[model samples]
Target: MVVGATRQSRFLFYVWQILLTAALQGPIKPDPGSQLGGDPWPEWSRSAESLASSEIEQECRQSVDSFLRRAESSLQSPLGSRHPNPRDMLFFLHVPRTAGRTFFACFLKQATPPSKRCAKSYDILRLNVSVEGCGLLSSHDDYSVTAVLPPTATVITQIRDPVDRVLSAYEFAVEVASRHLQVPLGVRTPRPPGKPRVDTRNVWPWSLLVPWMEADMRMRAAKLRSTRDGALKENNTSRREFVRLRGHAGGWAYYHSLASGASKEELSQGDVLLPNLDPYNNPLAMPLREFIEHPIVASTIHNGAALQVLGLTNYSHHRDAAKLRGCVAEVPSVREAMVRVAVQRLQGMYHVGVTDRLQESITSAAGSLGINLTGPAWRGKADAAFEYGDESVAEAEAPTRSDGPYSQLIHLQNQTDAILKELSRKQKELEQLRQSSYNSGSANAVSACFSLRALPASA
Candidate 1:
């Protein structure tokens, strides 16, 4: 019996050693490199690459989450050690073509007093003035030390897909130009003729104008950097130093000259202007091809010059190949590091509590003003069947429907139905939440104001 037991024990020991060896060798073993050159394509390297990407994404998220948590805690504390003055407000650093309009409408309604509700955009720019006693100030101005608010002020901003923003901007510029030429050449109503007024509604072709736009953006960025760095004269009275007045006023001549090195006649009357010239017939204007070719603009518009100028750094543009490639080139080790931190930070800070609180604030304020939070009621039924007759025909033809092929189709359909239902429910819930938030915010603001008024002015 003793001999038999020893033999069994030895067999088990051998099995353990084999497993240990295999475990150690599995990861380090070199299989034939998937690609011809041994450097894996993105897809080929996905297994290993994804692991790295995920790690980086996670680290970046975490870092952002931590930073926001610290900021939120600072805002919420009653001791006021982190945020000394409750009156010190948060500016919604508006990045044009983002969701800034919706946010600003909501924010203004909550912050502004009923008497001063119609305050102009200029009124919002002045730093020292209390915005209807909410103390918040915001503008789409370039970065300047003089423009800086108190450090206690929490500046928040939103970012959008840059390519989309640029496309939208182009469309807007075109619309403005068309509107200016209302009496198109031979129209009966000969309108007062002048340069077209630039507004948010015009359509402009950005692809042909890309080089020009890029030059403008670069100049803006350089100017901003100089001003921020104190290289520009402190007393530089040029409004361009403070705000993007040139672009707003239809001064693309400078950029055009810089980009194409072409005379004004060449720019206005050349083949290059074909895209913008015939706005109605252009197919490129509809789907926006710039996203495919010029992805860097997406990053630049959202987080680069725009954010820096607005003094908001919390939001980030979506990741693109350029960002990934740059990180890979500059600091390969830390390439993944920053992304991971941001992901972690976002998850930690942007929680249910913050969203809930914000919603409550929005609802309460809106309710007091009798503004209906529900804009347009959703008309579709919860269980409306989606028409997929022809679409389903191709899906039904697979032979192995029972397990691998058909099961996937069934699962996908189920998921789609489930997601639609969830989305519908969420939309309804969102409307209610917004109403509640406005109410809560109004009450809080009034309470804060009253409390402040009661205190000794000197104190």
Candidate 2:
């Protein structure tokens, strides 16, 4: 039987490789069951001993014991001489792209009371991280983290791959901009007359969302014309170019400068201060500029840096920059998926950094505290059902407005709502699977499914 199983495992490996190659190169889609050609990927990839029914419970008990022992040691002798103040325990720093939503869900499970178990309000770790004199903190934007957390508290964070993070950010921006205009998927809409043109480029002038472009322009023109007649007198051609160029650029910057008390000369300099200025028009420089100037789409891009920074004071063992960089470079697909997961889970919400890093840091910290940071021990049961009621209601009540853009906006919202609901369902299923192993005396069931091997001591 052992020999037969080993042969079956080898056969499954070849099948997986073939399917993966097909998926990458062509339109071939592997069904979940046939992906491994009858052999389960999870069981085959795992060590035979790990899945053996005879010693399953024994191994899990031993693993839990080892983890608890490690945790006790960590809690007794936490790294750093200055002990964390118990009063300032819950530190929630919102890191943008790391797997924050999942982590936050874990936190919600830890912090929430059993009686008041609503998924939306259950921040078990968030509250306990503060009230119990234990240092439980997360990196994500929230009034609790921004306003309530003590100033002296330690901040924690996580990061993801840069390219994936940037792409996620772009997708999020496209989603937002699409909602504000008559744009379909894969289509760009024209700017309305007298409205400031939004350049879908690096700098997203957030203030442009305010409907003051025409009024602000008239004010700036009056100021520019007055300046032209006085101390800033120049040739008519130069003056026309300056005004025309400034107007062409958009009024957000000018209005922002004015609001911030910058002088007219300073504002004028800003208008011409092109960060990507290229007098010789070099080809190499153009691509370099495009790369650097690309807007950060997902928050995970800064996870490595944020974790290292936060770890300086929070943890005794800080991950080396080279190691972090290697990790980011190695897991491009996982990073991209994490970004999409986060954005889909928290659409239009203001908790950017909070989602990615905070939960990861806390989980790591929990592991240090001797908690079984994986399996049923760490998983929480979430009851957030994905209801398509909002989408149905919107579809039934088409607005009376004749504006195409307004109708498009409503339609996009419905689509976004559906996507969000589907994502939420997937998330709930994943969570259930994660927690099921713990409840069923099978600690590593979910990890087994992923075929994750324990890193060697050196790693």
lDDT of 1 by residue, 1-27 (tens): 022443333332322222112211112
Cα miss at 326, model 1 (Å)?
7.5
Model 1 residue 149 CA deviation (Å) reads 2.4
Q: Runs in model 1 with CA error above 4 Å?
A: 1-86, 114-126, 129-134, 140-147, 159-287, 291-299, 302-459
Q: Residue-wise lDDT of candidate 2 within 1-459, one digit each (tens)?
A: 022443333333322222112212212222211211111212322543345543443433443344335434433533221333443333433343345445544553355333333222111112222123334444323221222233344443344665444434333332233232222212444545543322322111111111111122223334443453463344333322221112212333222121122324333432533232121122211122333343221112334233323221111122122222222333454335334433332331212233345555565556433445454433333332111110100001110122245434544554564466567779989999978866775646766755556655565
The C-alpha stretches of model 2 lying farther than 4 A from their native spots are 1-88, 107-148, 176-363, 374-459
- Per-residue lDDT, model 2, residue 338, is 32
Q: What C-alpha lDDT values do all the predictions have?
A: 0.34, 0.32
